[model samples]
Target chain A: MKSTWMMRAFALASLFMAGSAWAEVVVKIGFAGPLSGPIAHLGKDEEYGARLALEDANAAGLTLGGEKVRFELVAEDDQADPRTATTVAQRLVDLGVRGVVGHVTSGAAIPASRIYDQAGIPHVTPSATSPKLTQQGYRTSFRVIANDLQQGTAMARYAADTLKLRKVAIIDDRTAYGQGLADAFAEAGRKLGIEVVGREFTNDKATDFMAILTRVKARQPEALFYGGMDPQGGPLLRQMRQLGMNTQFLGGDGACTAEMLKLAGPALKEGAYCTQSGLPKTKMPGGEAFFARFKKRFNMDVQLYAPYSYDATNALIQAIKTAGSADPARYLPALQTIRFNGITGPIAFDERGDVREGGVTLFRFENGAWVAVP
Target chain B: MDILLQQIVNGLVVGSVYALIALGYTMVYGILGLINFAHGEVLMIGALTALQTLGVLERIAPDLGPLAQLAIALGVAVPVCMTLGFLMERLAYRRLRNAPRLAPLITAIGVSFLLQTVAMILWGRNYHTFPQLIPTTPLEPVSGVFITPVQITIVVVSALMMAGLLVLVNRTRLGRAMRATAENHRVASLMGVDVNAIIGATFVIGAGLAAVAGVMFASNYGIAHYAMGFLPGLKAFTAAVLGGIGNLGGAMLGGIVLGLVESLGAGYIEHLSFGFLNSSYQDIFAFIILGLVLIFRPTGLLGERVSDRA
Candidate 1:
């Protein structure tokens, strides 16, 4: 009598769980980024993008495998530290999230990718641009943004061909993103026969670059390329101007943002160029409507990676719908082969899990804003 | 030669700010035998407050001239920082005065972090572009090397403040009281000096110096943020120790020397390191000098003053 009752109780519990699963599925999508530290602004920006995507998808009544699904964002703060990133990734995986949207910086993303790869979860980074991220050969790891290779080549070509500049000085912050972009720029500049003059490095925490600027000034390069984020880029620009070395300044996506303008202020001059990884917002598919909706929902302007992050979330959800299930293992293959038009562009990953034909848009700091270089 | 001269000029400008900040560290250490780790946060607070004041002024009085705006910002920053310093001593440091030395040291660190978090929430984490009141026109007193008006102002202003500080510490009745307290707080108390009030005054004066230094730093660098204080503060502490902790003249001398070493060392590090290290490794100069000074002369360059002799 006791055994029969126990069996019946177990059966009833299973039935209730199945019923709930049938009624509605809550799919958790993980997001890991620096939410609390110095780079928290960028992480928060991407998180908001994912949040908006989730809200829109649920409001539209997303259905996967004939079950109405509510997409949930499980945002984790990696603090932009690589070690913390791995822990965050494991935590998200343990939480049984179907997919992930970010570990914003290349430094954090590279290490976190291993954790996601082991868990067999589809992880999409919206903003990390190191070419090595995809080169790791992880089947589940993918990026929505163009890698540094494209950015660096474009920057080099712009310097050599568009501006007709030959000599360039390179300064990197020595992080994965900064150094990788600088290395790529140097390689491309060398290939184009432009003189790669005075390659220097500073750490990310540094505020002083006068010594490096002075050295770069002595070399008298026609252009200065800094591969770092806005904080360092801003001060470097100011110091460069102070040293009276008014060279054409070029940088990769790290230095290309609205915040850069605020940080650099009057130091930002015309003819300063930067390359971002996607098409201009106006040029993206359904970008204008999305931006309008985003502003209405969040009451803030989109920072650098919001559109890409929005697309990343949508693409993950689309893959779930395509696979007819929210299980990461079941949907990941669908994600690999998924072809969907997204806010940024047509979202399709190549075999290496890099966005196919990822676009690079050139921008110039003009009239106190970043304007597309016509 | 021109590059050397230019780096020296840069060093001196930076060093003067260090001297101003170091004076605060030395003064507090002299009187209380405490490190006052939050001294750097005091600098950060001053800069951020001034920036906020300038922001308000810009919005309310767009037609205000840059000089007037600067004067008003400084006027606001100094008093606010003075109050912050006073409150810090009263609330955080004063309680731990009789505790184990380690207790106060840890509390100082905790106070530093607390201030950073508060400032971060208040000002946001991103670097705000501090308005440039001083023109950045390069004045070439020497060929092939350029110095901005801002740099000159930093040097001149720091020099004037240091001179004024020397006069205050040596001439006034308050100065005598401060010196007596630093020499022997218990004896000075017995001699009718208000030991607590003098300590508070020392913090206020140091905070005032920090406010000016903070403004100069932000103005010279053209950006300001919450974390901006940590590095300058650490370097300034080094300057204080290097100059002999309790000596006013030593603090100024130590700051300039350290600055010159950093500037010249950064310019020549690549050659010195046989092409391995470069200007990017400029931070190493401070640590190296600090280590060398601690090893060779524990009492510091000018010699430390012992407040209590058992």
Candidate 2:
């Protein structure tokens, strides 16, 4: 009698589980970035941000088309390589991910954007800032951050108007993002009457910059602008100091990271400046609460792009809710015209799928941290 | 003129580390006729081990002097790398001694990849800032030219080590046994030279040099990562081949010459290419020289012993 009673309880539990599973619809969102490399910390930050957003969405217990919905995140490592990005994108598509929030570096995102477009899956990039990504006119490609043009213009304006710098040199790591930002900065600097004394290029994997710095030093520019991430930027600044250049240093969002302060160490001084693609975190709409919650969840401080990533993931989910379907075909239009207030700010995409009202902020290294220049 | 001097100084510092690593490749090739492709990974292991030691030293003895801490780290790294080298020879190369040449070469590559993967798991993918035990403050040895104390240390230390190695090989009784083993293992064994011991000693000595080179490389650049050894390792291999794979003096000379060529190439590539290219083409100079050397002087500079042995 006891055995029969236990068997009946097991049968009832299994039936309940089956019924619930049938009633709930599982939706997968893909996230791809460099998860194992020098810049992996930044990639992981973005992934965790997306994860938190999904967790929050799941907890809200929303119903889509009268069925309870569940959200799942599928992550892939692209290693920040363009070739690997395409393969990861195809893999995500094959895995039936309804949408993607990924390909952090512009080099990876631009190439992977073609894959998502071909597969008819929409992808929103949280950190990639190269203008060409959206210029390609792919309906599936959307960006939630300010492009390189805005960042470069803001930096050049600050350099000319505020710092009153007359001449500067430029260096790039030769990735799509680096080169694009460097070119945009050069163009804007010319318009602002700031002479670009020199331009040099290096690869993303390089650690040594003595040779190039020596060449740039000969030009004797008052300031130097480097368009690359912190990995290269840190060493470059150190080498520049070693060469005794003592010139002011400027960089874009790629180098405007908390990691830069640690990597550059003592070389990052008062003269070092960078431009981030959005307002400072303290100025964001829900910045304080987000920071406390993020720290509680991950036991780490937010890196550069986490807030934007969180907003992008939420934007996708919001679109799915408005469309009342998880199908990419059903939600693509909704995503294109979606409007919502995000942790970063108000979010709405324009005709080219670039985020509207995107703002840029300038920061300077002060007291060993990036301080907003106001 | 000042720019030229700075580039040359930079080249010499980088070349010294390459020469040190190349010695390991050359010595192993001389004795066992093996390229020891994983030799670079040994250098990487040495650097990371030193970095790990430094971390522990910081926690346990935070008040230690920088130089003393560095010495302790090197002391630990050298022995660890030596044991690793001996184990690699005993377990991997000894069994493949009679296999086809391609087999050992492939095995060396596999071992290299394995070491990198293992390092990745242990250290994770973040680039650790190698503590600058030696101060990086620049000193102007000449007007308009900057040289850091770390650079001077690298050059001076590499020269001392290379000179010591030369004396050991040329003057010691054990060196005589090593030379005998390299000439003919079967004949050396018949003559009671203890061929196995000499080969093992060769790997140990090479690994010791690699450890020093690895530490110096990280110190000069101020960063350490798992994949840091690949490029330097390949370049050092090119140096060994360029200097004549079996020759010690040739390895040193090839490394310095290659470094100079790369630095000068990067410094002037813009003017040479009429602005069509930049210093990003710096890596091309090494391969170009390697190609030219292989085509014209297959025996390499100072390479009289390679053809006679094999």
- Candidate maximizing TM-score: 2
Candidate 2 per-residue C-alpha lDDT over B1-310 given as tens digits, one digit per residue, 9 for 90 to 100: 9999999988898789889999999999988889998999999999999999999999999999999999999999999999989988898888898898888888899889988889999998888889888988798658789999999999999999999999999999988999999899999999999988999999999999999999998888788889888889998999998988989999999889888888888899888889887777888888888889878888787776777655
Backbone clashes under 3 angstroms, per model: 0, 0
Candidate 1 lDDT tens digits, B101-183: 89988999999999999999999877788988998767765777888999889989999999998999899988999999988
Tens-place lDDT per residue, model 1, A1-374, is 99999999999999999998879988999999988765778898899999998888899997766778988999999988889999999999999998999979999999999999998988899999999999999998999889999999998988888898888999999889999999999999899989988888888877777777777787889999999998889888988888887898998887898878887778889879999988888889878998888888889888778899998998898898888888888989999999988889899999999999689999988889999886
Measured as a fraction from 0 to 1, the native contacts recovered by model 2 come to: 0.70
Best by DockQ: 2
- Error of model 1, residue A18, in angstroms: 13
The 10-residue segment with the lowest total lDDT in model 2 chain B = B301-310
Query: DockQ for the candidate 2 complex?
Result: 0.69
Please identify model 1 stretches exceeding 4 Å from their true place: A1-23, A63-67, B306-310
Q: Write down the worst ten-residue block by lDDT for model 2 chain A.
A: A257-266
Q: Score chain A of model 2 by TM-score against the reference chain A.
A: 0.95
Give the poorly placed runs of model 2, Cα more than 4 Å off: A1-21, B305-310
lDDT of 2 by residue, A17-54 (tens): 99988899889999999998779988999999999999
